[model samples]
Target chain A: MLQIKDLKATIEGKEILKGISLEVKEGEIHAIMGPNGSGKSTLAAVLAGREFAKITHGSVKYMGKDLLEMSPEERSKEGIFLGFQYPIEIPGVSMVNFMKTAINEHRKHRGEDPISASDFLKIMREKKALVEIDSALTSRSVNEGFSGGEKKRNEIFQMAMLEPKLSILDETDSGLDIDALRVVANGVNKLKRDDSATIVITHYQRLLDYIVPDVVHVLFDGKIVKTAGKELAIELEEKGYDWIKKEVDSE
Target chain B: MENDQDKIISDATSGEYKYGFYTDIEIETIPKGLSEDVVRLISSKKNEPEWMLEYRLKAFRKWQKMKMPEWAHLKIPEINYQDIIFYAAPKQKPHLESLDEVDPELIETFNKLGIPLNEQKIFTGVAVDAVMDSVSVKTTFKETLADRGIIFCSFSEAVQEHPDLIKKYMGKVVPSTDNYFAALNSAVFSDGSFCYIPKGVRCPMELSTYFRINAANTGQFERTLIIADEESYVSYLEGCTAPQRDENQLHAAIVEIIAEKRAEVKYSTVQNWYPGDKNGVGGIYNFVTKRGICKGEYSKISWTQVETGSAITWKYPSCILKGDNSVGEFYSVAVTNNYQQADTGSKMIHIGKNTKSTIISKGISAGKSQNSYRGLVKVHKNASHARNFSQCDSLLLGDRCGAHTFPYIEVNNQTGIVEHEATTSKIGEDQIFYCNQRGISTENAIGLIVNGYAKEVFNKLPMEFAVEAQKLLEISLEGSVG
Candidate 1:
């Protein structure tokens, strides 16, 4: 469903993601485990078309279309969802209104009529139930004064609302307690489908316990140096990334 | 991406002012220049009483001695007073008994402005008094208002028919010697609205006045006076627009409101004078003095204004809480774009014990415009336990624009509780990108962010005025979303 070939991204003249290539098919959960400053977030930002990150030399094809050519909004309309590590707090825009505008814009891009008010509310209720988010939290301004756990769950709630074909969860478990981690992972697990794919980017292997990945890739020095089955996460968690760094250094 | 944002800003700043069309109406204007004879001409032309003429002469003499204020953070060029026409009135039937008697061109002009003068077509429960150039052409629902002992008429008509009320209340709140603009407005002010709600009576409908400036070189000095008698309640609205011109026109207006014992008054304004072109060569110099006085115990007065036009705006709609336990409020949203400059806020003077006041001012500056919020909260020695809360927020759209806040607070009584807060923020790229990622366009995203930023003040306006104010904000900030 998504393809990246030698993707090199830079921000402020400093290369972050250097010579990175990955491919993910439908119904697959790919976990990219890396240490700090390993360019895991940069890869997600590049896929989401963040304007600040410049793609120095790379090709990202999503559903057979060049993703780098599209704007951030167009990428969103094309079903590319990037769950930000630090969700932005917009003080005045209510989550309900934000979702309505997003849904309608996506529908407009697809040549479909706007969803009716009743249908919209029903979908909101259904999505709220999926993520176990409080209705009051969803009614307020987007992420304004929201708890850390609530913000992560709200991201999942939005993912459920958008129903994107390719979802990239970047450090979704960061700052989340065990209970919040379980709720968020369960929400993502429930939304998984045969035609959709998930890319879980994390610094630790703890998040993979709840939302198990089919393929685990270790990213070191802006390149994925190791790829293995789910058992690789357990081995890395037991042995640590230092051993992997030593191996990559020698290679 | 930066180029895309620059394009958006340029497009928003370059959007045309939609209400810049002039009506081709023959106007009878006094020759340009100001003098004793000119003031007398305006007074006599309105058929003012001898007392009114003496009042104008007194104000004119005071204005002659008073120099234009230079303290505001504005770069105002020296105004050539001798070159401006003091009065201009559209030529029409002298007396109008019904809508049909009014000139067709005048009716068409109002219709184009979406203000229907025809009583039957007015779906909202609003009585409108239409003022063009110098004179008030018509005031709708006058007889219906008169049935309830509610006096709603033109200032000229009040001077002629209800001289006692005019004599007792005129310049009582905002005196003729208030300031430079107030003195000037008092001298040459031709016509405006006069409304009086009787004791214990609530105005049946919202009272509104639409002012338009059409004649070239003519300065519109309108005077509006509203009085809510003891136990009475009323809501008054004012709106203004001017034609596009190469030479800046002057709009110096005076509005005075009085709320008696247990009375309540809500005054709202949507000022959309011509804001000149992108280069800021010409527009309206809107120097207005609007004040309300709570004169009796438990009285309440609120001023809500959305000022989005004019090349240079210097206005401070203030309130004087003179009665014990009285309440005063000032809510404003001022927007300036493309070389427009505005220095506006409100003054809350707490003179009575235990009085309270609130001020919420939001300023949005885009393009090369500069917007400043200058406000003062003063509590006298006797005003013990007087409380005041003030919040002023400024939003900048582009790097070239500027926003400033000047809040002055004075409390003589130790028990007075005063709090002031101010914040200035730009429309950050992250906020824009967040909205864009949600599928909203940059234009709509700016609108949403700006509206949300000014939502507090917008909520204080009447429903219709709130909608109009939002639209004006969108227009004023159009294409300014870099």
Candidate 2:
């Protein structure tokens, strides 16, 4: 469902992502493990069409269509969701209103009628239950004054609400307690379908234990140097990323 | 992003003023100039009593002796009073008892402004007094209001019918000698709305006035007076719009309100005068004096305004809490775009024990405009335990725009409490991108963020006016953000 080939990106004349590539099929979950400064967040941002990250030379194809050509809003309407590591705090914009606008925009792009008010409320209730988000929090301004755990859970709730075709979770497990992580992971797992895919980008293996991946790839120096089954996460947890770095250095 | 900014700027600068259309009709205007003769002619045109004519002459003499005040942070050219037409009115039509007697062209003008004058089209329970040029053309639901002993009509009509009330309350709140513009308005004021809510009576519906400047070369000087008698309550609204012109037009208006013992009065205004073009040629110079007095114990007064137009606006709607345990409030949202300039705020004076007041002002500046908020809060020694809270916030859209705040507070009473807070912020790029990432376009994001910022003051506006104010905020800031 997604393909990237020799992706090289830069910001302000400094190259962050060197030659990198990956491929993912539908119904599969891929975990990209990388150390700090390995360009994991940059990849996620680029995929979400962030304007500052200049794609020096590369191509990203999602369902055989050019992904880089779309604007950030268009990419969102196209069913690509990125759960931000640090969610933005939009003061005065109620969560319900924000979600409604996002959902209606997506529906408009698909040439469908807007979801009625009752149906929208029902969806919100269902999603809130799936993620264990407080109704009061959803009624308030979007992410304003929310605790760290609540922000992450809110992101997952948004994911369930939008029901995107491709979900990218960047450091979603960070700053989350064990129970919160489990709730977020369970929400993601419950929303997964055979026609969609997931990419979990993290530095640790704790989150992978809850949402098991079909394949594991080690991204080192902006390039994927190792690929294996989900067991690779356990190996990395035990041996650390030094082994992968040594192997890449020796190669 | 650069392209987006360019598109926004072009959009903001290119759109024509929507209320610029002129109506073709026979209009009678006095020769352009200001003199005792002109003032006397205006009084004679209205067929006023001798006392009324003498009042105008006294105000004209005061205006001639009073030099224009230049203390405001505004760059104004010398105004030639003799170069402006003092009075202009639509030719008199025979007195009629129904809306059918009104001129169809005038009705069409109101319709074009989205104000349906036909009683059948009015769904909301708002009685409107339509004032065009220098005279009030039609006042709807007069008999219905009269049934409640609620006096709602044009100032000219009130002068002839309720001469006692007019004589008693005309200059009680804001005297003719109060300021430069007030003196000028009192001298040659043509027409405006007058409302009187009797003792122990509540106004059944919202009372509104729509002021339009239709005749060319004639300045519109409107005077509004509202009196809420003992134990009474009334909410009054005023709105205005003007056709675009290449030559600047002056609009000097006075609004005086009196709230007696245990009475409450709420006044709201949405001023949309033509704000000239992008190059600052043509527009209305709006200099207005509005004040209210709480004369008896337990009285209250509140002023809420959304000012989005005028080439140069200088106004300060104030209140005097003279009664014990009285209350006052001022909530305003002023937006300036293109070459517009606005210097507006409120003043609260506490003379009574246990008096309370609150002020919230929001200013938005876009393009090359300038917006300022200047306010004053004073508590006298006799005002023991008086409390006041004031907050002023400014939002800037483009790099070329400006926002300023000047708050003055004086507490002579040791037991008085006064607090003031001010903040200035710009529409940041990160905020826009965050919304864009959520499937909202940049323009929509700006609108949402701006409306959010101004929500506090917008909440104070009446329901229908709140919606119009929100839409006006959006239109005024169009093409200002990227």
Worst 10 residues of 1 chain B by lDDT: B433-442
| Quality class of the docking in candidate 1, CAPRI style | medium
DockQ of each: 0.61, 0.61
In the range B395-437, model 1's lDDT, one tens digit per residue, is 8888889999999999999999999998888887777777776
Best by TM-score: 1
- Model 1: residues with Cα > 4 Å off, grouped in runs: B1-5
Residues A1-251 of candidate 1: C-alpha lDDT, one tens digit per residue:
89999988888889888988899999999999999999998888888877777888879899999988998889889888888898888777788888898899999999999999999999999999989988999889888999999999999999999998999999999999999999999999999999999999998889999999999999998899999999999999999999999999898
lDDT for position B284 in model 1: 96
lDDT tens per residue, model 2, B166-248: 99999988898898899999999999999999999999899999999999998999999999999999999999999999989
Badly placed stretches (over 4 Å) of model 2 are B1-16
| Residue pairs whose backbone atoms clash in candidate 1 | B12-B478, B12-B479
TM-scores of the models, in the given order?
0.97, 0.96
Candidate 2 DockQ vs. native: 0.61
